[model samples]
Target: MNLNESDMKVQEPRLWSSDGWTARVVKNEDDDGWAVAMTPDGASEPALVGPWTMGRDKKNPKPLDQSAFLTLVKTAREFVRRSEQQLHAALHQSIAVTVGTARVTVCLDITPDEDNPSATLSARDEGDDLLAQVRVPPSFKLSRSSAVAWAEGGFVKPR
Candidate 1:
């Protein structure tokens, strides 16, 4: 179905609706350029704020056409999926850290050795050089800030 300017136009800047998310290209508050915001349905605020770059770089953002709208929806949906996956990874799967001169990767891994579960923490250099191995207990803990900092330059001296 084709969506014309009259059909897409709304009285107000849509925050979000239960049906789905909405976004509009407008002048950036920080820059004179344009940007598109992705706000999920019923959301009070935008979830992702990115500069609209897929359209023809003309004076005006190319109208949201059928093909373009479908592409936009697919793109936005994929972004949401990736975001969810990253959140899940941060919560359950694995993490790689970057300390000043070191990188540490930690993860909860379950192998065929079900009789012996393990949490492995492998430290490496920025050039992907293996530094050391630390066998953590099954009850290992991790957080985003801690992981980021540890990856940035946080490490304990091996004694």
Candidate 2:
């Protein structure tokens, strides 16, 4: 093999490749360098929105190319969609335990010993408090009702 005959073009792999996740850079709200947002392929919204975890620097954001962006969008979109779906499935099925300004829904999935189910419910505020926990038959019954009830704190505990 020739050591260095002439100028050569080197290719590279996309950023943040996982089993079902991807990430890329986009224009920041400030409209300066770049910020990263994750979107699942089939979803219309971004799954995670934060300073791009896998970018170049604080000021200079990595270039926004099609290859990387597409992958990122697909992965992120799927993540968002699945998360939403899981939450939806937990509606009336999970258990409910309201606490504080936030509503925590604990969704338990597949298990013989309910003491520790397979998965947990989604949706929580800044503070991790138990708002609602769904643990049986999986339904979205507590979506809004629980929040309203918790806010008022007028309803007595259900027997």
Candidate 1 lDDT, tens digit per residue, 98-141?
55555566444423246876656555555667665565555556
> After superposition, which runs of candidate 2 have C-alpha atoms over 4 Å from their true positions?
1-34, 38-46, 50-58, 94-158
Off by over 4 Å in 1: 1-19, 53-58, 94-159
Q: State the displacement of the C-alpha of residue 94, model 2, in Å, after optimal TM-score superposition.
A: 7.5
Error of 2 at 121 (Å): 18
Question: Residue-wise lDDT of candidate 2 within 30-139, one digit each (tens)?
Answer: 75655676644345655786554335555556555666556555655667679878766543244445565544543344433356434333433337554444333322
Local distance difference test values of all predictions, in order: 0.55, 0.48
Give TM-scores for every candidate, taking all chains together and pairing residue i with residue i. 0.43, 0.32
The superposed Cα distance between candidate 2 and the true structure at residue 43, in angstroms, equals: 10
User: For candidate 1, what is the TM-score?
Assistant: 0.43
Give candidates' CA RMSD values in order: 12.4, 13.9
